[model samples]
Each structure stands twice: as structure tokens, then as C-alpha cells.
Target: MASRRAAGRIVRGLGYTSAAAAVGGGVLYLSYRPRDIPGSEAAAVPPPTYGEGGIFRPPSFPNVKTRAEQIADLKRSSGTVSGAVEKAQSGITSLLKGDANDVQESNQGGKDEPYDLLVIGGGATGTGIALDAATRGLRVAMVDRDDFASGTSSKSTKLVHGGVRYLEKAVFELDYNQYKLVKEALRERRYFLDTAPHLSSWLPIMIPVDKWWKAPYFWAGTKAYDFLAGSENIESSYFLTKSKALDAFPMLKKSGLVGALVYYDGAHNDSRMNVSLAMTAALYGATIVNHVEITGLEKDADGRLI
Candidate 1:
């Protein structure tokens, strides 16, 4: 126990030393640099490149309105919220191709016009699948019984951390699948934060440890979680002394408090994100419709899902 406490003290001292050295180095480097060099002048911005720096002419969506125009129209629309929603919906619906404006039109287009992928839900999973299919140049269509994200997608607790609980289970149970789930989730967590800064952000969380003996275990596990994320890891996990943790979050229970594990995950607007996913898929030529019910499934002679 004495040795363990001494090791902890050494680690904390080294951390403080490292932080001070970083600050000193930064200050010295800045002091010695050319004062006249404007930050922007230090780097030349590269010219924007489109289509492999003049490869064979890229395909264009002829007769398609610019996204700016659609957004402008929505912003300029007036009247009730219902009217605005209808107008916005119409704007999105107009982007569909090959008689995708109506389900009846799709039927008229015949068996030849069947979608490559017909996703049956409008939540995160369905919209994500539609987006993936559409981007790969497949004919994609999605339908929902109600508004997008009206179901479980909208019921998220808004914490986008890796399934640390799953990771814990994996560690104890020696389950590889659970570890893979954590890794996959961490990758997605990074992608979500990077791809949609408007709807998502890095959120710091505190896992309070109640006993001195438990702090090392919590720290090791969290550090392993950070390592599993590789480049996608948001922020490294670290120990926070009891006073510091209390300073960060005063409402934390004081009794039996030893320290806390501080780490980052993501927080997001689930509903807005779901809508964006579907709209983005629509922009990529997928047909997305809501308020459409599928009461039964159709099957062929082989009993394939259709």
C-alpha cells in the first residue's frame, strides 16, 4: 500500500512536470519565431480541386437546382409551421428521380423500376442504410409509418459514449464480439462528431470512484478504452482527485468519494440527425417517404424478403 501510494504521487508529479514543460516549450517557441509572420501567411491555401484535377468531365445533374436555392426557399417561406413543413417536404420530395414523387408513380414505373434497396424504417438505422445504398449508386427508397426518428431514434439518452459497460463485460467474460462492438461504436462516435458538428459535440463525463483501491482499476480500464479507439479517441482518460472532481461537478456525492475518471464521448440531437441522414440520402438520389404504412411483407418463390 505504501509503495502504491508512492507510485501514484510519482505519476502525478510527472504529469505536472510534463504539463509545465509543454507550456514552457510553447512560450519559448513562440518568443523565438518571426513576429512579423501572420498566422495565415505561414501556410499557403491550396487551390480547390474538383474531379481529379481535370479528369474526364465529371457527370452533372442537369436541371437540378443548387442546394443553396432549396435552403433559401425554405428560409423565405412564410405562414404557419404546418405550411412551412409542407413546403420543406415538397422541396425534398422534388429531388427524387424516375417517377419517385409518388408511390403510385413508382408502381406505374413497373417491376423494372423496383428499388435496389427498400428500407422499411425511417429511424437512424434505416436512414443510415438508405444513405449508404444511395451513395454507392444504388436505387434506394425508404418508408416509415410516421415521421423520421419518431420511434426509438428519438428516445436516445443523448450520451454517445462507447459501450464501456459492454467493454467491462467483455473484459470479465472474455467476449471478442463485445470488444468489437465497443471499437465499432468508438469509430462511429468519432465520425458522428466530425461529420455533424452542428448536431453533435464532444462531451466530457465523470465516472466517480468511491474507493482508493478502485481508482487504479477504473483508470486502467478507461485507459484501455481510450487505447481501443486508436485515432478516433476523443480525449485521453485521466484521473481527477476528489477536490478537483468536486470543483468540476459540485453536486457529486461527497461521501466515500476518492477520485473520478474523466473521459469524452459525444452528445447529439438524435431527431435532427435522423432527419439529416434521410435528407442527405435523398440528395444522393434516394426516394424517402414518411407516413407510409407497410402492413405486410411480400415474398417470391424462394421466400426472399421483398
Candidate 2:
């Protein structure tokens, strides 16, 4: 019993788990012993390849550590810790892929946690508020009742659209809103589709026209739509005949669909896109969580409603 306790002390002092485990087996593993580090193993470590100009890409995402520093970690132990570190980075790719499986149901943080601003909701609007505030270098906290975008945001028809149909009417009710929505939608569309090409793309939209005169009307209007969208409208608009339109959509009503006015609109996995938005917020160093309850508000001495 005395020997075992002595072994534990020696193993812990050397900061080696294998040596501690070895003591249980009545043998000390030389590798975990500090003495072995300066022997044959120390000489075996190949000089770093960076100075030798070996082919190695930089780490995939954000890491501030240097190449030599990371290489040094690989030499300290078996690749177990290295592999665990890589596994942790794999979660980075999962995050960039916008997987929400990691979202927690309840948070275990602190109350009265210091934050410059506590955003009250976690819908797209609120999330955007938090993100905008955080990116501007503000200390912020955001909360949600359910998984991010478990509200009107998730139900959005998965199109960053500018209301191509309504624009023809020249509706003035929300003209600036329409313009802002169109510009931002297309801009945001380009951002998402570019980063995750495997999941998002520009889908051709075929608006069937029954009258021949309607073809030019739509072409002109849609071209304007393209202009407003700027570079995000990677493609142009065109009119199609009954045969051409049918070729694009076999399921489209053949007889009633007479001819189609084809235009480009962005499409994506709505849930996946929302998840990506949250991940992007995370990447920018924002604190986010899901399934939180906001039961009260605090007011300052100024008598401002909290």
C-alpha cells in the first residue's frame, strides 16, 4: 500500500498517465518517465519540416498557434491527444456545415453574467440583432426559447426572394422594404451558396404565361429584378415556348402552362441555412443557446422598462 501511493506520487509529479497505469502493473513504462524523454526518443524526433519546405497545408480554419507549436504537441505523446484535437476540429467542419445536432436543450452558464447587451429573443431578427451587435465588438448575450430559428424564420419558404410577382404591380406600400429585402436576400444568398455549394444553388424559376404579350412584360420586369440583385443574379431572364418550358419542368401543367417565363431564384435547405446562420454567429465569437426561458426583465434606476 505504501509503494502504490509512492508510485502515484511519482507518476503524477512526472505528469504521465501511462506511468501511473504502469505502476498498477508493477512495471514503469519508460516513455512516460521524464528520464526517458532525453534519451533515444528525443533524438528520434525529426526536425520540423516547415524550415525544410515540406509540403503541408495550413490548418483548415481559425487557429492562432504556429506550425512549429502544433508539431511539437504531436511529439509529446501517442497520437491519442492529437487525434482528440483533430476530432474537436471535425466539429468545426460540422459547424460550418450547419449541423444543429449539437444544439443544447438547456444551458449551464451563470446568471448576472457580464454582458453589455442581453438580446431578448432568438428568432432571425433577434439573432441578427445579437450578431450585428457582437460583430461590432460589443459584449452581447442572446437567448432563445427553442433551437435557433424554431420560429417564423424556419418556416420561411427557403427563398431569398424579392417578390418578383409583386414588383410588376409596382406596389408602393413597402417599396423601400422590398428593395432592402431584395438586396440583402440576394447578398445573403450568395454568401450561403458560396460557402456551402453542396447544399445551396440557384434554381431556375419558370413562371408560366398564358398570353404572348405577357412574355415581354415579364422579361422586362424580371430583368429589372436581376439588376436590383446585382452580381447575385448570376444568370439572366428569358421567355420560353410551350415546348421549351415543358422540357424544364415535366410535371408542370402542359396545357394550362401555355409557355413559361423562366427566371432565376435562389433555393436552399431552410433549416440548414438557419443553422448555418447560427454557426456563423458562433464563428464570429458570439454566445448562443437554445431552449431557454425568459421569465422576467430588469429595470435600471432611470425607470426605463427592462
Candidate 3:
């Protein structure tokens, strides 16, 4: 009888647990289920509408060109390009044919107009000479074995410096020639930078001072350099502190680093500068040609070049 009573109690406990679980689940479902607020239906975005063509188009779709329009544009571009190419070819052909005709006439002993000066090369020096002669009202013609500035003129260090090293030698050895060369170079450097402002620029160069004593020495030397440049100086020389030096040149050795002296010099694109010189000479009425090799020179009985 006691066992039967215990079994009845267990069955009643299970029935109560099941009823609690059902109530909890119903409350959870009601609390967490999605609900629509009062004005949310009106606030919702509507589906995009397709126009009469039954196709959806983006905002930019109307700006897009049709196939025929694109084709016409391409055709116009190609025609412009072809016309420019043809014009360039005609100019080059005319120049080459004219040069060839001049040579042929000279070889055939025909009396052709003679040039006042005939430059044998198209390097910087030769082109400069041609330009000078042409500007002075002399007929000038220039030819090169290769393209202009193809040799050492193009392979330079590209620095239009005033020979700071030469100044050092001039001071130490008291060499008048070196001093004069430095002065001339400084004047030429100024002229070069001024002439081709587009191709050249002032560059700041730094000299590291490893020793404390060397700081004042380099500073004085650079100051002297600026003095020599005088009114033509691009910028004045300045001394930098040790920390500032490191900031400017991060790769410098920190130990025994006293300071640095910064000075200004001119730098340029050498090859392009040389080519521009040649073109300028041409514009000054000098006939400039390239890729014409001179195997030999002919001289008259009076030892004059013919």
C-alpha cells in the first residue's frame, strides 16, 4: 500500500512539471514572435517599377552610348591619329629627301648654295656652335654619326655643379688656373640653369661632418663657396645640428657624427637637355641631322675644308 501511494505522488509530480513546461513555452512564443508596429506598413519600401519596355535601368544607363555612337567615335579618333601620323611622315620624308638632294648636287659639282658653317657632330658642343652661328646670321648645317646626345653628353653625372672640389684644390695649392676654372664653371652653371628652367633645378647637397673640428672647416668652405658664387648663388650654405643631420640623412653613422653642411647646386636631365639644345638650334635656322657618318674630309689645295 505504501509503494502504491509513492507511485501516485510521482505521477502527480510529472503531470505538474508538464503543465509548467507548456505554460513557459506559450509565454516565450508570445513574447519573442515578430510583431508589426502601427505605421510600419506605410514606412516599408515598395518594389521597383519596370517601365513600358519591361526592363530595369540604372540611373547611369541613359548616359551610356549606343553601339553605333561608339563606333562613330572610334572612327573619328582613328582618323585624327592617322592624319597626324601622315603629316609627321611627310615632314620627315621631305627633310631626308632634301638632305639627299643636297649631297647629290654637291657630288655632281652642281652650284648649290653653300652653308657658312657645317658642324660635324650633333653633341652639345657642336649643337651649341651651330646655334650660335645661326643666330649670328650664318648659314649652318649639323650632322651626327648617331642620334644627338647618344655619347658622353647623355652619360654625364647630370650635375651642373660649380666645381666645389676644384675650389678645394685652388685653396690648398693656391692654383690660379683651378680658381679661374671654378669661377667660369659657376658662371656657366648659372647661365645653364637660367636658360633651361624647365630642365634644371637647384639641388641641396650635404657633406657629413664626422669630426667635431671638421664641422667649422666644412661650414667655412661652403660659406666661401657661396661667396664665390656671389649674386649667382641659388641658395646660401647652412649648417645642420647633429640631430637634424640624422633626420636629413638617416643612413649616416650615428657614432662620431658631429653635424653636416648643406650647399646648393644645379642638376638637370643631361640627354634631354642636349636634345633640347639641338632642337633650339634647329629653330634658329640651323639644319640639324642625325645618323650621318663622316668617313673622310675633303680639303682644297689651299688646305681649306671643302
lDDT (tens digit, per residue) of candidate 2 on 62-162: 32223343233222312111132343354445456664233110111123223444566777677777655544444345667778778887798777566
lDDT of 1 by residue, 1-306 (tens): 999999999999999999999987864563344433222232233444567757656444423224454333323322121232333344345435442334222212232344555679999999998877655455556779999999999999886778778899999999999999999999889888778877887777789999998987887888888889989975667677789899989999999999888776788899999999988777665667777777876665666544
Model 2 segments more than 4 A misplaced: 1-113, 169-184, 195-199, 304-306
Candidate 3 regions exceeding 4 Å error are: 1-111
> What Cα-based lDDT does every candidate model obtain?
0.70, 0.58, 0.69
The candidate with the higher lDDT, 2 or 3, is 3
Point out the higher-scoring one by lDDT: 1 or 3.
1
TM-score of every model versus the real structure: 0.64, 0.59, 0.62
The TM-score leader among the candidates is: 1
Q: What ordering of candidates by TM-score runs from best to worst?
A: 1, 3, 2
Using lDDT as the measure, the top candidate is 1
lDDT of model 1, residue 26: 67
Candidate 2 has its poorest 10 consecutive residues by lDDT at: 103-112
